[model samples]
Target: MSTTAERDPGKTQAWGAHAPTGLAGWVIRICHALPGTSRIWYRLTRLLRGPIKRAPVRPFDVNALGMELRLLNRGNFCEMTALYAPQFYDVPELDWLAAQLADGGTFVDIGGNIGLYSLAMAHRLGSRISIHTVEPDAELSARMRFNAEHNGLSINLAPVALSDHEGIATLKIDARQRGQNSLQDGTANGQADTREVPVNTLLALCQSRDITRIRAMKIDVEGHEPRILGHFFDNAPETLWPEALLIEHVHDDNRLMQRLIDALGYVEQGRTSRNLLLSRASTTGG
Candidate 1:
């Protein structure tokens, strides 16, 4: 089977060359000709920025899978096309999430980035599900807030990095990759610029919100995923554990991560090259 990176060129490659300057571009041009859409089209073009990492960030919206997501695509070429013109989001994981989360179910998004997972869940599942999204970037968090409110979705936003410990930690950011920020020493130990951001363990987050019964969870915190999850699975009660999970597994540490989840009685259900989906052994598969 093809990897997620292979299935979606935009996921890892610069899409400016393969993108529909052909058919997709033609349809976008047609949309521009329609009344009241010209402005949006123009803004969308600005958002699909070039390969300059220092370029000004541009905020725009694009419909993907089933959600209309707000994005800041500029300055990151790979993320721009992937998030904006996305060939396809994580279909397998998304399918599992949709099948598992019933109305009134609870979902948690760690390292929410721009809250694409949250928006997609709310759009597909409606106001019945409560989504708690954790992200450390103030700007991206605000954009996520805008998308949730504009779409009339109920998403609780927490603007802090979820780590194994509480208090402040140095968050390392990729100058070129906005989604690659993390609290791991490998990512944070460099002389590359860092920021002291408040951190909280998943247990603390859930307790503060009185949130329990998490049906599903998605984690994508660069290299910090293992530590974040280690804290949860080791300490959180079985009731607080999610029945389904989507975690980015494209890391060197993921070999150990599998053992960690296995010890918690979770079984791997599916994979999408970039991520893995697991279902708890104690819970029935959706």
Candidate 2:
């Protein structure tokens, strides 16, 4: 049961050494100051892919949510967006989650891209709480390990995807945008590479950690949200459910999942631009 930090002992030291410099540093500072500039920078990078690809400084270090993040600006969309607009990145959702788990408990991050949410919670709650981050992407998981180590945070990292059934599943990797990588088929908008990743059920994951209750959980598994969540709610007991749930509902057009959550005694707290916030009625007095 070796931890992610234990497995990659040198990644933090190696990657954390590089920081943005010169023109890149200046541009990054501007983007951080004016969040809107991040979109312009992203578009410009997309337009001038050849030149940006050959740029010397690709990975830039930034302090985000009290954690030091070494972001790769070229392929990963999450890192690039956070690199510039860290302040505004999921501010509302993160705030809501923090408030919900203020007393300290287990927090699970499903489809954790580079451990932003998990790292943020770890930094905020400290050793009073346990954090578990599940990510199937090899590179992103490695980066997440580096980030946790660099920030001096302890988190349980599970490098496995969660689905309705347990086995190997095809994860479609969006080459141009790593954040768009998904387990759902035919969801890729651009050129996608596929890889076979190990899959497990959410209940099994919790059981493996001996977790009986969860304070909050954030799940952003692209289009595969319904499959994972539906199965979990159907099989898991109410005590095992998270008191607060932040689910990415951008791809859920029919809102079937919302109805399912409501039927399971979870009331909608609110909605952000990309996620729907829900809390259990018994726990939150909904």
lDDT value, residue 247 of candidate 1: 81
* TM-score against native, each model: 0.75, 0.84
The lDDT of model 2 is 0.77
* Model 1 lDDT at residue 31: 39
Q: Which regions of candidate 2 fall more than 4 Å away from where they truly are?
A: 1-16, 35-57, 184-192
Q: Per-residue alpha-carbon lDDT of model 2 for 1-286, expressed as tens digits? A: 3233323434646655657676667666665665434456546444433443345335667776666787765666667667766765777888888888888888999999888888888888888789999999887788888788877989899999898988887788775677888785332344347777888999999999899999899999887887888789899997898888899878896575657565877888889778888888887752
Q: Residue 154: error of model 1 in Å? A: 1.7
User: Candidate 2: which pairs clash?
Assistant: none
Candidate 1: which stretches are off by over 4 Å? 1-56, 76-79, 82-84, 184-192, 252-254
Point out the worst 10-residue segment of candidate 1 by lDDT. 6-15
List CA RMSD, all candidates. Answer: 9.7, 5.7
